[model samples]
Target: MNRAPGDGLSAGEVARRLGVAVTTLRSWHRRYGLGPDQHEAHHHRRYTRQDLSRLEVMCRLTGEGMPAADAARAALTVHPLESVERPRTGSALSARAGGGNTIPVGGAGPEARGLARAAMRLDVATMSSVITRMIGARGVVHTWDHLLRPVLAGVGERHAAGGGLVEVEHLLSRTISETFAAVPRPAGAPTPRTLLASADEEQHTLPVEALAAALAERGHRSLMLGARVPPGALAAVVGRVGPTVVVLWSQAPATAAAGQLNGLRGTPLVVAAGPGWPRDGLPPSAARPASLGEALDLTLRWLPTAG
Candidate 1:
């Protein structure tokens, strides 16, 4: 059973967080019986917050020349509460507790993951409840990074694997994308004139809207071209907008369309984001964004470089 206040940390997690070898932690647990407090029926080991803290302190003390036994004793004697912890009520931290550090969907917390599950199961009311609660509580960006992004990524994967039923995937994508665009941007930001388009046959534009939002947030302007844009049209938009960068999204499993980007060489910054980016055969005309976060970084970089 997970003792009150905290769930058990897996053995691997404990070792990684404490900067110790798995073997070393296991040996200490065996020799000094300093292991975590719970072992479920499946033989999965879990440790409390207190247990992890104790281990951390023990490791710190031992690193500073204290003996292992002495370190262990000191660790067991101290218990510092997490900042997110509320006294009296004693509720544990939410999964989104540690800002920017998102736990995986399978891990704890119901807010975002629950919304995702509900959406996947086509439970409309539950999905609405979760999203409304999140927006009411933490605002849009928080919901985006901490919840929406993960959920979309999950949905996309499930859709690929024949998991998204009927029109669920399209509905979820449109709803989330439109919601993102609806969130008000701060007034008179950069507003840089730029075109947002997806390459030929690359129908995924979720990343495009996301990239546009990020750019808008930073004061650069964007013109959303949406999905399935051809290269000639893309080049024309660049000429019309005179944007510092022309952001493109592709999720088609191959960069064959990327070859068409040759028309955009020196006219504008050519940035590409999606799951379909080539690992080895990318042309120099386009840059690959490793993740949404990375895409944001690249956009920021383009701002200063923009004429």
Candidate 2:
């Protein structure tokens, strides 16, 4: 059905369509000059088709982890003449010419190269699609170790070198998180016998997320407590849940306290994952997995057997 000229959707309708809060729409309008363009006598402002299109762009970009200001700017610049569908393979990263400043993938394959290019252009759709395809074909462990990790490390390297591409890193991280979350778990899998979390004061959860998805592929399940889980909270959850195995991840030395493992003293297996842990400081009972593959294998072995 074609929307007639001068007929526009109300704020509530637009919000429902976009899957955003009504207040979000108002804030986007007030902050970014993205409100309705259709004004009628004695009635509230209404969003025109063009206005909705711009808002769609804004929502997509922001959802993929672009800063609100940058997303709004990109939204404003989107013309009605552009195609509304997801970008084609060759055309997605067309904005970047010559690939001079692209993210360094370091001997990775075409998929990683394409992902880096998409990330550099901040093309959310292409980045997500590429990641989802890779995960589907390669499974979580391979995709994380081979495709995602190298690109993420490259993004980190670039950011460290010049203090730039923070937005790109955020976008790429968000995309990876979403893709992992969308992976399907096996049917009729036993109740989760393992728990995964970031170490106390740790903010990195992507590795744990990857581990969870990998376990799902093998018909095992885990309870994932994302970023910055405190030591006390970890203890409380372990006591209450009675998980057979617990994996605590710390991405930096600052968050990897050996005492955190002490909190899980009674758990049958405590795996200290990530690089943050000091080699000598780990608890004698805790096992450390050096890579995603090793982590998955170790955790699977610790899962409870069916009676």
Candidate 3:
């Protein structure tokens, strides 16, 4: 049920609904004079519906990659009661799932559309909050295949066509990497038996990171050798650590040499994941997973004790 009009929300509640930190809320308030008007001196501020409406506009504007001060100026101009509605139960950013103006997420769900919007704005906070929430609710594997990939693919498509959104692509990659890195690896899990790495000269590491987070969700710990490991260096690590399974990812044809697979001939199982690998030349030492789920399944087969 909705609270009465006189009722007000605290800064913490406003921050939670807005998909931003309380510290960020406070910063906006201090920097832009956007704080609650209902409070008198010395008492804590309680945001009224009007205040909530203004902040909602603020979030939407800022999320479109606007300068904070300018967004605040625009938000302040919004008429009270005009934009205020029943605030959604989850993060306010979820309310923006309808905007398909900038990024082309092509027939993907509201969540994917919402994510693509955040990516275009380079709105790191909303993107990260949405991604973390989805991963927690849906598990990492499903989140990767469903939410993340669709947006990433759309970003790629847009980039390929117009040569724009370079900033969006880079920001999205960094945000995904940071979010996946935060996924909790199981405690007291056996020493990591799976090693994940990108093929030599390969700069695309997001897929590898997704597999690592997915493994973590299943109560298995895996070692990550992120991005562009030289063939000799990868071989040296394999020999020293002796992982039961190793997964190598390559995202482009230039980075997919058959020899990278050959370097790990002694490992019990090696996964040559990603489309980068040539169809015919994979050494018997490595197997290719058709998707993220398959990579997890293939790795778990080698490390049967994985939780």
* Global local distance difference test of model 3: 0.79
- For residue 271, model 2's alpha carbon misses the true position, in angstroms, by 0.6
All-Cα superposition RMSD per candidate: 13.9, 10.3, 10.2
TM-score, one value per model: 0.57, 0.68, 0.72
lDDT over C-alpha atoms for residue 89 of model 1 = 17
Q: Rank the candidates by TM-score, best first.
A: 3, 2, 1
Clashing pairs in 1: 8-47, 9-47, 190-219, 191-219, 191-221, 192-220, 192-221
Candidate 1: regions farther than 4 A off: 1-104, 121-142, 160-164, 186-191, 254-256, 304-307
Q: Compute the lDDT of residue 158 as modeled in candidate 2.
A: 90
lDDT of each: 0.61, 0.79, 0.79
Model 2 lDDT-worst window of ten: 90-99
As a whole number from 0 to 100, the lDDT of residue 22 in candidate 2 is 77
Please give, for residues 256-275, the per-residue lDDT of candidate 1 as tens digits: 45576666776556776777
Better of 2 and 3 by TM-score: 3
lDDT of 2 at 124: 74
Point out the higher-scoring one by lDDT: 1 or 2: 2
How close to the true structure is residue 174 of candidate 2, measured as C-alpha lDDT? 92
